[model samples]
Target: MNKKYNIMLLLLLIIISPISYTYNNDFIIRTSVDMKYAFCDVKTNGVSGANNRSSVSRGGIGFGSTSTNSMILMENGENTITIELASLNWFSQDDIPQKERNIFHPNARCEIVVNKMDDQGNIIPLTQLMVKINEDGQPEAYENNKIDSSIEKKIILASNTEKIESDKILERVNAKEYPKDMTVFQFNKKINISDLPKWPWVEADKYEDTPKQRELLQAAYLELWTAFEQQDDSKIKQLLTPSLEVWAASTGGNVEEQFASREIGESFSKQNFQMIPINWNNFQPLIMNNGKMVKLVYKEDFDFSPVSYRFTTEKGTSRVAYHSPIFSFVNGKFIPVI
Candidate 1:
């Protein structure tokens, strides 16, 4: 009897199997305002010779998003990443210039050092990694390289104030993903200040310039800080959102000043607030938990702008912002809601 020798191939496992990485939020946004609505004043240098390109895209951070002062990822396995949001940087394509030709591309590149931890909380080796989530409910790191990451690995939303420098992967996104006409989350429609509507909190009230209000506050805040170093009442009032009347009345806004002494009146005098109109867009009257009539929606940012207010005395110049803070309007006043 002749028996044939059986040959078998054994596969070896390397690195680790089923590597899981989680994020803190749906998508990572850099805004100059608060946390929840990190949709404005984004830092995007990644756009290819286009002002309309966004900084954050499908695979990674956009061109303008990267910078020397960007955040770094230092992990030891199962760690949480904190990414700050900038001002009203995020907007529909129409708001940005040359958007028709420029596409959305997040030049994603970063190195995540996941340190494994022991039961005692000591740093160990690779156990798992993760990225944060975003407002869109979409997670980073595509499956099957569909979105095209240079490296095929578990991806997640990663946020930081510093630029994430990585050679692990590269990703790309085109105009198809971001439709030009998509309505911005909280910003007013594309229109000049001349077309601004009057303040309208309720449906039957009156339409207003939503973007203008935000811009006015930003500019007025700068003027108040610049003129008196914190004592400019007119600017304080002009910058105050109609809905924020309560907060302004209660805390006496402009008492503390913008961030610190560096943010002063000289920083805002040339802004020409005369042309700025009140921003009144999406905000509407809604009942609060206590049945109190209040506008529940106000959009804020989560990151700082790479390039902020230039403090120019020139007319018809771009207005710089401090941060985006989603506010809740109640009784014709603005109440900042994180």
Candidate 2:
């Protein structure tokens, strides 16, 4: 009789206790592109995340120009990853010698590997996709390349972080920026008023030319720059999407902790620096996810935007640091998506 009662209690415990699920909150995208005279960009789940443009222009081998970046898996179901490569018009702005231009036709070889983190923190590759650009600068499948706009996959999350609600997300994304009266300085230089264009100055994928939308986008970028200059991780996190927050938490502690760990701002504060405003001249709108999201791309590189800082070392050498603060338009307001 005692044994029977104990078994019943065990069954009751099993039934009454909540079932725990590991939801994958983050994944890593490894991108490699070899281009003779072209550039490539990688977009996962409609968000442009990584690219190979920076390496290509620096006169590197341009082979094995790779980047590994962590991205948030927003949900536990199907997610789409799309990568596109385009040829560059190297001599579009300037007249070049025919021999220089004839040396290499615009072509690139690109590969992308998507991997998910298991509960044990091991990287398990989900899929591998590759593409090659022909001499004519058109994308062609390479080695089982079934590149499609709807390349979907089901992902199982391994993290227990609770997803924030959409309303709360909207609140965070729409948080007010620091007032103009606030003194924001970078490298001991006060940031002057932003000169970002309010209208579509260059041709792009799409444009929503509305007074309200433009104002919100401008404000979003200003807030982003302000947060970076102040090194306010909490404020910066407030500007990012909840998915990005989850990605930060999954990798380390939280967004603030992750930013603190990098110490990028602290290092910059120690040096003399010059601020490079957003490349307004190259700003172009990229509509993604069937118009559900939008990204302001610069020179076709989605990861190179918003603003940059040029830090000078004691030896008079300098390196420019680019910040990728992505945003999406939701409910008629702009919010940072990454």
Clashes of each: 87, 5
Residues 1-338 of candidate 1: C-alpha lDDT, one tens digit per residue: 11111110010001111212222211111111122222222111110111112333222233332211101111122212222222222333345554332222232222122232233546533311122233344323332334424322322222212122331011212332233333231111111111112222221212143665445334432342343344454553344333232222222343233223224344346454322222333222223212211221212111211112322235544443333232333334333221
Of the candidates shown, which would achieve the greatest lDDT relative to the real structure? Answer: 2
What lDDT is reached at residue 170 by model 2?
15
Per-residue lDDT, model 1, residue 171, is: 21
What shift in Å separates residue 262 of candidate 2 from its native position after superposition?
3.4
Q: Judged by lDDT against the true structure, how good is candidate 2?
A: 0.41
Candidate 2 residues 96-208, lDDT tens each? 44334323344455667655554566876656666665455455544454444433322122111122332111112101111111111101001111111111111122336
Each prediction's whole-model lDDT (CA): 0.26, 0.41
lDDT of 1 at 247: 24
lDDT of residue 238 for candidate 1: 41
- Show model 1 residue runs off by greater than 4 Å: 1-264, 271-275, 279-323, 329-334
